[model samples]
Target chain A: MTLTPILAMRWWLPQDAALHGAALDREMYLALWIMTGLLATAHLVMLVGLCIGRREAKRSIWRLEVAPLLLLTILFGWMTIRAERLWAATRYAGADPAVMQVEVVGAQFVWYFRYPGADARFGKTKPELVQPGEGNPLGIDPGDEDGRDDRVSSELVLPIGREVDLRIRSLDVIHGFSVPEMRVKQNAIPGQVFHIHFTPVHEGRYAVLCTQVCGLGHYRMQAAVRVVSIAEFARWSER
Target chain B: MKIFSTHHRTIGIGYLLLAGTSVAIGTLLSLLMRVHRVWPDLNWPLWGVIKPEDYLAAVTMHGTLMVFFVLTTAPQSGFSNLVLPEQIGSRTMALPWLNAAGLWTTVASLLVLLSAFFVRGGGPISGWTSYPPLSALAEAGPGQATGMDLWLVSIGLFCIASTMNGANTLVTVIRCRCKGMTWGRMPLTVWAWLTAALLTVIVFSVLFAAALMLLCDWHAGTSFFVPAGGVINGVVDTQHGDGSPLLWLHLFWFFGHPEVYIAILPGMGMTSMLLANFCRRGIPAYRWMITTTLLIGLLGLSVWGHHMFVAGLNPWAGTVFQLTTIAIAIPSTAKVLNWLMTLWGSRPTYSTPMLWSLGFVSLFIAGGVTGPVLAQPALDAYLHNTFFVVAHFHLVMAMAGVFSIFAGLTYWFPLIAGRRLD
Candidate 1:
């Protein structure tokens, strides 16, 4: 069990593409190290006990046993406190108003993304008006004034170095919207909207996948997430 | 009275055999899933290429059979029926007829669940959790028709049977102990079984209610779990409206999380019992071990929301669930520390049971350490519904529970069979 080869298995995690990826990877590495140390120490103690201890019945005392457990509790408490802070910061912290906003609606076998146009507001959508492939995949109300300039696309194109807040929903069944590289995942539940925010620090095309078992075409339910430069995003959104 | 002549032991043995068969079949299904993962295009005899529907069916059957039939049946019902009374110096369970009825009912449920594979359109594709409206609408997928209905009925039957066994075990433990067998004098195995039975009764009732509600949504046209204005398979679901899908997730995981403990607590107790026996010493912190078990049981109920963190739960609720879920690690860690300390100053005899016990501890620790990572809603958002969560649970719950079952069977083989396994 050499350390080099195991740590070298970097393919286990997708490449870091989001601003928070480095922080998450660092925490993951730290947790793994702590777990490995604890595992090794426990096994080592067991080995020594087997090799050197007597078979005679010794009255077990609480004082000696409780010491290690108390230490473990302290360590666990410290880790939990640290991890909780990180979680609260990521999950509960309010999103930046300057960040880009995208609405993602997932159906049985496809992902549909909507971007607010120059008005910076999205038009209302009615479930009754939802008719897929009839020029209204997301059921954007035709009569709504703000919806005329709303750009609906199948691909999610984000501007790099800027935070993006995704409001996720499902038109039908439950689906999971996941981008492995960005370390972002949130369920697209029907009748409810889930908010997930991440900033792509790198410019790359990543595969956006549905992690949930949606249906028979679950394996093929995917979309492309292209993080482009600001200029390129401006040009693309204009088109 | 002849022990084997009584219906208690016979029913116990029957449950064990059925559980064994279920495990065997479940393992094969899991193997199919593994094979399909690596070689997606591979075709097999009779089944041909493993289509997505087939894969979903295998996944569904594998989880249902292993969780309900094998894990729940073998450790709690099977072993407790045979050994709990004997450990308490009693001849048989308090209600032998009820025990027999429970066993037979479980067998019937297993049959009904397996029958879905042969039905038209094959077995249910909704996975074991059976989240709706995929599970609610027959037109949602291929197997959502007859197979989903049978799946619900089977689960309902299992819940009833498990509740009966839980009641019987609780009654027998309370009343059938020998005159001198005080609570303190009882073995750890008995304590584990008692706690597990308590959980089974409480949790399975909720599960049964959920199953019934789901059945109503399926057949009786009730809108309990199915939301209105939803479309499945390109058709609008007109029968149901204004229902909440999240309602089902809340109810299901409420029972589901405790069900994890029900599957593992007995194994924990059995491991404690074996550690003491093999090391030729009592657990170092015996009172703490019992206290930890109780704490784990109580804390287990509060942590069910962890499963819903990524399922669109409120962020504040997710934080609360995360805290409770992390609290479980405290008691769980105490149990592990106590086990290690029990073996600290004594030589451990490496019998088959002892080996299994050691393996259980090692595997459990590996599994337990991963809990805190997943307990974080921030982290679970990344890991949920991935193979990472799957591996985490398989290591902690399934593998750990199975190891304890193996340990118990090997330890009690001589007493049960009147001859040593070797």
Candidate 2:
């Protein structure tokens, strides 16, 4: 069996499947072009020096080196400014109040997602009330009035083109909530809650992966993310 | 008695041997992981099926060994011990006994770390970072039991050894330079070693303190890292509360980011020295290269927050880290340009050392470019903990350091052995 195909694999990134993925791809390509240009120039200079330059013709061309350094510094600064804007748009910008909010709690080997019911509020949770399989995987207080209609599902269902605010949590260990296609990842820390927002650009099924090595079953910790139409999402939520 | 004497050269050779052994073992572990990745279900007669726990253990060991033993040991201790004194025209280190003690301590630490595999739980799967709650609670996984304890002990010991080694190197460079061997005339490799030693002194101390705190949480019921309300396997751990795992992340990366520079700076030094020597000319911007090395080291400290961007750090703090991280590219780019300029307008020798130096430059550039992308908090949110990260770091830190080590070994083989391998 030849390993050529595996060794010759050229693609380094997974497909862009999120609404903002195109921006990331563009930034990546821009970085690639800059890097390639710099690398080629450096190698070409070395090649010319080795081939044609006389050994005794050593001269300190400080300006030649400084020129590129200045250019690179300006480019890097501009890129950073642009990146800060993109980052702010994703992280610092407040999530839209009208969008859907989902609570995702990661465990040793599973992902549990909770959708606020028609009330649009999450129920109170206490660590003492957590029981994995006895109808309280996320430990929602049974007595809390707001939790009565909360829909807990093993799978994550999001509506296409609609923004999602995910408040990620963990029950035990640190687990990473990663969806390669959606270009989203955040660590689910046991004692902390992390919020990330993204909109699904395409309608399809994607895998929710645990990127952190949580435990023995870390590799198998996954759930299906189904992006459906708004009507279908509403129907699923009602059920 | 004389044969066992604590000479700097002997100590250096010992460190190299230990580092070489670590590289061998670490490579074997990585190969095992690769095999498991390609053929997950393959069962061998002796090793049996690769269990998930086993895979994690192998990964943990591979990273720990490579980072601590091979990268840290070979470049700073292994190379510096033999060459630093000679470069400065000193016959011995400022404190020869401390050098030997550091080497022996490192050896003992390696033994303790390897003994984790023999423990009942069979090595910690927490990876090299050993993030808490998972690493703190024994009930979290099989490896978190006795194995993690041994891992911590081993690391604590190694940190102590590295501290001693760094002090010795720093003092030697400062006070022991021979007459007329000014700092300006000293080789870039010597400067690299000095810078690496300085970083080791500062960073390893923090790591040691963190390890002690982690150990305290494990044994003394301290909640330095184990946050409150941690439940593992349906059992609520009631011992510790109010501890934030982010504290561990902050502390670890504070040392960890500089630790990457500690690994690569020496390689950069070696590449610069080799390029200048093989080209038989001065590097175009010699002072700038040294200044940039210092700048990169200083900037490395502030950029550690980039690692925590996806770990739920405040967005504003992430932005600060992103800016600092992007700024680091300036010094790094200057170094690359200087290296190319060193090669320009000279009789380029295609020797093995020169070849490896060229490879290092190319690989470092390729790896350095991806860094800015990850420096962006938005992009890092997606790339963190993925193969993309693994690829970036492996290119920058792992492969680049390995190439420089090869270059150094090849360049110095003849001087040490009186016969060149080639």
Candidate 3:
């Protein structure tokens, strides 16, 4: 009946660690507060109406009902526009060209992250060459010169304060690439690639979860996302 | 109880009983899921330690049963069969045999669906949405083979049953209303049933087509929903072509969004009538109530894209769906206000039916205010597929619809059984 446990543990939203997450958290809180207010007002009216009973007076339905509803509609319309602009700002706008590029591959129940290495150019991948047992999970072509320095890992490590554009795709079924702390979620579907970009503001370890139901192993389809200092990230990549 | 008999009350009671059984099983399935969620490692006598496949099977079956049998059937088919003719002053439904046929077919459909649990691979692991290549590829996983086929066939049968019943309701309302039972003169409940039946015919047909297409992809090597380059369980599927998963999303939600209204509109009508009856007066804004009901039905059809904002839909399309989805709030808000206004200043009895009606409104408001929040693509970007969505629909459609079902049963108890339920 109460959220005391949830509140005490501070488990809501899980310590946002991305630069854009604060604004998102603010937007979510604003919407929740507004919705709470609206719910309270409606319930209060219902309670009052039930208690006092109906007055048998001749009244214009327009003034008593339609006008207030119209006002509420306008308010909701404004809120929709505000939320739409926020979405366009985040999802529709292009990321900076110089933003760091990371390839995120989802297959079955595992996540694979690839860095372009010092060349800053991602190597080509072939679907037929995708043999996880052969140590080529992403099927990066061996003949591509740029692929010689490419690095692949099960963990996603990023440098703090650097905007990272994630090219997300799935080799098999559709998978959802989600990180709650970063306010990022996008479906990684086979035969297509989606680009989602964000900047991690704080250095911390967050959970990377597959939000879509890919198969039997969906529950365990998880990975770790570590945001570290630029020097630390360089050191880890070098290792 | 004769299978061929065309009695209206018998079929209605049959529908209600069927729904009751479904809700019972559906609730138990949900309880199993909740228990497993909190204590996932607790080994069971029957299933032992629950694997993810077992958990997903529960999810798929629980959703399928609740949505199809309980929510859709109980509100419109069950209650409407009992009351639509009587309220309109007709002897029985225009096509009573068709009505009985619909009920039994639904029973058979339920059996086919339940049989999936006992199949070799267990019930389908894909959620009720059944998004493919997971759903399309037989080698995708445990449930994707035979269990998935049973799911599709069951859904296909359900579509047929629903379409037949919807047509029967529409015909009875249109042709069988007794003298002077004009459209305006009909009770709000009749109007609600009428609109819901209209939606059923239009949307169920689309769903039938989708289910059949999925079945073909499963057996006939058709690729209506399967795309190329999909590897299932490490096996590459060369059978795929230009098919898209988004196409299925569009077709499914096209029926899926309005399906909620089909579940709720009758309840809205029942709530309005019950609120007025218990309050000892007609709904203050009866015309407005009808208008809002129709508006909800119309707007519900276009907002299916709201469910796909995070499913790779065009951002521009997302904007449009957002507008239409938000527009629904106006009518929905009006319906709630109409109930409150009717309750104002009228001392009403707080009996079982009235309490259920009140509960419907309370839950409706509690659940509905979150509509616009999820309607926004920006917010949904984070909240989609999260428990936020699960809670929102449970509050709005599932729980609210169940409350209305209870309200209808309690209100119509005496008329059908000739005695009040204890």
**lDDT, residue A225, model 3:** 96
Clashing pairs in 2: none
Fnat, model 1, is 0.49
Interface RMSD of each: 1.7, 1.7, 1.3
Output the better candidate (1/2) by DockQ: 2
Ranking by lDDT: 3, 2, 1
For every prediction, compared with the true complex, DockQ reads: 0.57, 0.69, 0.75
Better of 2 and 3 by TM-score: 3
Quote the positional error of residue A20 for candidate 3 in Å: 2.0
Q: What tens digits encode model 3's per-residue C-alpha lDDT throughout A1-239?
A: 89887788854667889888887888889999999999999889888877883577865778868988988988897898788888888878768988899999999899999999999999988777778898988888999999989999999999999999999988888899999889899898787788889999999999999999999889899999999999999899889
What are the per-residue Cα lDDT tens digits for candidate 2 across A155-216?
99999999899999998888999998888888999888988888998989999999888988
Evaluated with DockQ, which candidate comes out highest?
A: 3
Give lDDT: candidate 1, residue A41.
86
Winner of 1 and 3 under TM-score = 3
Winner by DockQ between candidate 3 and candidate 2: 3
Could you tell me which 10 consecutive residues in candidate 1 chain B have the lowest summed lDDT? Answer: B1-10
Residue B84, candidate 3: Cα error in Å is 0.4
Model 2 TM-score? 0.96
Docking class of 2: medium
User: Any runs in candidate 2 off by more than 4 Å, and if so which?
Assistant: A1-15, B1-3
The root-mean-square deviation over C-alpha atoms between each candidate and the true structure, in angstroms, is 2.5, 1.9, 1.8
